[model samples]
Target: MLGVVQTADGLPIHHEVFAGNVAETTTLIPTLTKILKRYPIERVVVVADRGLLSLDNLESLQKMTVGNRPLEFILAVPARRYGEFDTLLEEHHAQHCVGATHEVVGELVWQGQRLIVAHDPEAAATQSESRDKRIEALEQDAERWAGKLVEQETGRSYRGRKLSDAGVTARFYKAVTDAHLGHILKVALNSKDFEYDLDEKALKRARMIDGKLLLVTNMPDYSPEEIVSRYKSLADIERGFRVLKSEIEIDPMFHRLPNRIRAYAMICFLALVLYRVLRMRLKAKNSPYSPNRMLEVVRRIQHHQVTLHRKQSAKGLTTLTPEQKDLFDTVNLPKPSKIAL
Candidate 1:
């Protein structure tokens, strides 16, 4: 397994390989240890999604320190999972409501821990719309599945898995769970077909916290807005990973030796560093082409060479297009020459 760590500015800082048996969540400790040992930054804040932090991990992190100072962290919390927060959330919404699409709705002390809650109306709307669409499609699927019962009554059958009551229940539940609406969707299995119901109360509860983001943090000096901003920097980290997987093709390794695998990973990491540097350079110059796109354009330019029987060989680069020349100028890179060295 491979792990990568990056900064808020979309720059990769560290990477490591792990045994296949190592759970992804367990890699955090070693990765952070290596990072802290190598960089020795005085103030370090680990910001991550809810999936990364267990209760034990949080406790361990709270105890971890650097240079005699405690390490800080901003972690997302599943607010809805904590029913105790419902009353507090209602109060928070009532007292700190704002008209903006997104805002820090409230900052409350829960279990003596600082919890900053934010709301995003746009995100909420998108989520609500998605759920509604999925539910609608699910209803349509139910109707079709029920129609099979009618066919069964008339002695008609299809050439796939035979439709059974148990199969219908299992299949429909799988779909519900896949859509994450298991709480809101209800199903009844019968000998004929299947019946399902939408739990209005459960759905209302789900919709209430659609875009509500709750963050738990140990950084006392930072404000709610600042905490939210740090958590949002996760986007840049994700972008770094995306660039590695898509552009560098870091996976599907064909190597047999461990050292060669590490070498490949190191090369990929270096390539990522160079890629980001080129990206920054292009952005600084306001170039229209991305580094990947720029490479595509430049690769089109070719060098031609011809030699006479007894004379020195002649070599020249193909003519550079206006776009290619402008790109080179924008990036301050010297264009290749046809002159033989």
Candidate 2:
């Protein structure tokens, strides 16, 4: 599913469900086209993650027009291509950016579009620490595997048949591959002898791009900071998806037909809409309770039947707590009646 969430309000304005096999990158243009046709939007600024911002999708978005006005976008560039922004990173440190946790460097024209580069010191530090830990762990794993290989080579312990040099090398390769440690480690095999070493060159290159991010956009008037902010708002869309799949329990769908699946998705979407409305109301009123807490309070206001004088009385509701009352008032929802048929 592709969701287009509004940055200003964090509401899902549009969504599309593709086949299970369809790639997320391929859905970007089609989803945007559907949204444009459905809404009377004169100008648009699309914000998306790196996975949805391929070169083809970027070109397509550039050429899109709404009533002769071109569409705008703030798309994140993949961090793997960090070398292209070396000059920008150097220039960013010299600039004075007050009250900002990140530094936005000037824009450059790339592939006929403006590219904005930003650096976050905190993010860089966190990423560097994480990478260092992974490298250390991989080194330890390499040492353990080397010891096992030695045991196999020597006549210390044997389980049935002994492993060949190729077998030992293959086993080590599989282990590192499973752990995703192949990038930082190199393995060598020489006829009954094997060795594993850290790939220092790759680790050094990764460190350079630790805290840097690149953003591509077609908006000429938007500053680098604004572009970065807009792109960061893409997280709102991701949060909406989480709400659908987790909070709303939209997954593990048992529907067998395509139409049924689509209907279920729509139901989840509507539930998200209602949830956001209540959330916004509570937030506007400065309420300190979360949606789940409010729901729990509401759930506590249950009803039960009573019998009186050989006659069955209507259901009677429990009294609401002060917190529940405050929540209802903040959300502008009327309290339930004490009794109901």
lDDT of each: 0.82, 0.74
Reference-based lDDT, residue 122, model 1: 84
Tens-place lDDT per residue, model 2, 1-341, is 43444535876676566788888777767776777788887888878777766767877887888788898888888857545555544445446322347653556666778888777767777887987887677667667767766776576765676655677678877777876667777777554566777887677656656676778888888788888888787777778778888889987889888888888888888888888888888889888887878888888888888777879576778888887888889999998878756
TM-scores for all predictions: 0.84, 0.85
The lDDT, on a scale of 0 to 1, for candidate 1 is 0.82
RMSD of 1: 3.5
Instruction: State the lDDT of candidate 1 residue by residue for 23-42, as single tens digits.
Output: 86788877788888999588
Question: Which 10-residue window in model 2 sums to the lowest lDDT?
Answer: 91-100
